[model samples]
Target: MSNVSSRVSLSDWGLEPAVDYIERVQRSDGLVPWYPDGPADPWDHVESAMGLSVAGRDEAARRAYDWIADVQHDDGGLWATYGETDGDEGAHAGDEPRKETHRSAYVAVGVWHHYQCTGDRAFLEALWPTVRDALAFACARQAPTGEVHWAVGADGAVYEDALIAGCASIYKSLAAGAAIADVLGYGDARDRWLETRADLGEAIRSRPDRFDRTWESKSRYAMDWFYPVLCGVLTGEPARQRLEAGFDRYLEAGLGCRCVADEPWVTVAESCELVISLAAVGEAERAREIYEWLFQWTDDEGVFWTGYQFEDEEFWPGDRPTWTGGAAVLAADALSGLSPAGELFTERLYD
Candidate 1:
């Protein structure tokens, strides 16, 4: 799968089914479900919009952005889950629940990404106050040592845990916030957030002990293997060597990236993200190969499975995930002549 000669075009793969899936979500109200079987999540909706945008479904993407804007909380935050309210007969029945702060911060990155892709300054301006407040909310939860706490209660209290995934989200949010501030001409705020980002990056690199021991205990999880390097938080000879070594340890020929070295199925999200990471480091050839593998995994419906669960003999047993679509869109954008050249990470590479 890593072979360079195996490149394939997105159009050659017959995208009609994927287009239909995107259209179904777009025609409905703002709610987009993670799977065909479960409830909708705002984060997933944002991701779907990104995928649509990549596929040039501009109108559908715009609708998704509008839907998210409509449902944002009064406190400048968003809920983790939203019940189906699109008036579809026989939709899954359940109570909609909002997550704590950590999840809320994750949504901001998607919103910011949408704004960048569309150049919708008005939409971005409308979201600015909410985005700013959310950033402050996230920043306030940062520990003295610069690592962000895991979550904040609805009552607005900090909940700390140092989960590696949450840390990745925090890094992403801060970077997105800095971009938003720069766009909005909030010079001081942009600098402040950038400084905060630098602090967090340094903390993560210098104090690996602060992270969960489980992250270090195994080299199997694709995220633990690639996220740090992909995020621009890891660099230099040692970092690159670490990633290369891990790739040899965990990468399989035809199955894509395994969650664990011994795992059989490839996780769509992890594989797509790995492509972005590879591209970020100037390995475009390898990134292109991974991109092809990812394109192969998409079903006829454009819905990507969560993972190939060999244990259950299931391929994405649940519904198509929003993040899976999001990863695909983001990676495709990067591959389709869209470079983060003037962005934070690109600048850091030369610095």
Candidate 2:
């Protein structure tokens, strides 16, 4: 057990209210939209569910995971975005449908995180097929160079361009998927996921040319800078160096992390995820400090505002996303060791 929890009181940090906000945003069918009225995306949906699991709201978390099972397409993927209702002029309505491989595969991480928090082997077993199919769906789209294609279009054509942050996330998902397979005694599945993950990781760490091939470079985004570390694709001293190398470019002192290198806007979710990444590389003290800087943006109701534009000196977009709150909860857990999976980002779970 780590004494990291001694450094900060999770309750004092507003963990309860953060969890409450996530639960409140959750719809009856367990959909966790970006906000009360915003559309739901698969990756953020899973991130919020992970927060529910960390807060000991296991049943609520289960419902969120169940939402994935309910909405998953037969191809083992969900559309890139989905509105709360089908006919409204909401965020995702009337948009061309595409399935992001990273989003589709993220269920593995959520399911494994849920199992770590609860130690429910039966639950893990129940979700195993979903995990298996989702990983397969992702792997099926991988190019020979090992970067998974970012998406499949509505016409079922593969989007050839890959994203650095997205591929980093897929690496983590494949790790979780492999862990699940190992626990269930599926040796062959475990081996396959491990093999795929290794190849994907090599592409991420060594072959920058593979990503951003079709679009303008996304290197300006903070996620592209740190997600490789956050998702455990980069670890040890190299992970620490990767974060340090880009620290000044992304961090805004006493505010939060910037969404992009050129922007003065600092997003709560990005800061929280950065906190976890810092902790992942044995920088817990700095991680704690960064995590503390975030509470100033929490509203009277305890949900975090989407982001702040320091240049305009206002909360931009005026939306408090459920996934933002979820990221905060997960960051706190990573620092304070509040749940069995508290070290989820700090340490590797599978082998």
Candidate 3:
């Protein structure tokens, strides 16, 4: 992180090609497949959509949000995988893809981002009901322990499990929901959501045992290590401390960030996100260092590879995810100050 100033400028690393990579694979109906023939997950689709918005492709971005509104289930959660041909997980082959709490809640984050970019009150109004219902669905499953369950079936049966990464995401989604509620004139609702977010952050910090009951602690996963900071739940000195805690475990020197603390694989999207997490707490020097390192992951077509295996010294899984390009564009905007919503990822969780 010492040579934070060692990057080519954002103007040289301009985001249009990366943004277009996502738009090119998006269907007319606004589904952004992970790849040309891949399934669209709600969260990744939203991410690609945000990148579109950042690239000044407003119409495509709005269409992306519209697709979410059009397909929202009565129960409010988004189908984890929709109209898919393939998935990273073999589980989505079912007729009805499973629902997940964090994926369902993420519409609020995308909705708020759209509003921030356009200042379109009418657009916010159009999306308000979707945001409100989605957050309610996730909140309804919150345990007395202050952790939201990891997922729920379409039948409404809860998984009753939790994850540090998922809950951290939901915490930020609630902040976005609260922002929407404030704009839509829901004082009590906004205030209540803020209160819940504070409680969730406490659980994440104090109760590591509350999460990932079915598997080993996900602290090994880079997302869980950085999400609280990315979400603004762990800001200022605490955020700085958290980044320091994970730096040696994950950072790969002149390479990129590790996908897992113990693994030799580094991923583009996680590295991009960590840049924002670093910037959120005034760690701009470190943020730029990582972004500069991540530039090495970009391919000739301007799309970033999904991940690289340092042990084998190659791009593993050997595919480019549209969302990875989206993440790169987003991180570039954060560093370049090129868009209104550039700071979206780094913004504070509560007013």
Instruction: List residue ranges in candidate 3 displaced over 4 A.
Output: 1-11, 83-91, 94-96
Best by TM-score: 2
Q: Which is the better candidate, 1 or 2, if ranked by TM-score? A: 2
Report the lDDT tens digits of candidate 2 across residue range 46-159: 999999998889899999988888878788877788885455322255565788999999999999999999999989988887888888989999999989999998789999
Q: What's the C-alpha lDDT at position 193 in model 3? A: 82
| lDDT of the candidates, in the order given | 0.62, 0.88, 0.82
What would the C-alpha RMSD of candidate 3 be, to one decimal place?
A: 3.4
Residue pairs with clashing backbones, model 1: 35-319
Residues 231-321 of candidate 3 have per-residue lDDT tens digits of 8778789889989988899988888888998888999999999998888888787888888888677788667889899889898889888
Please give the distance, in angstroms, between residue 192's alpha carbon in candidate 3 and its true position after superposition.
2.6
Q: List the residue pairs that clash in candidate 3.
A: none
| Model 1: per-residue Cα lDDT over 72-111, one tens digit each | 6666566656655444321234532334444556555755
lDDT, model 1: 0.62
lDDT score for residue 2 of model 3: 20
TM-score of predicted structure 3: 0.92
**TM-score of each candidate structure, all chains considered together:** 0.80, 0.96, 0.92
Question: Of the pair 1 and 3, which is ahead by TM-score?
Answer: 3
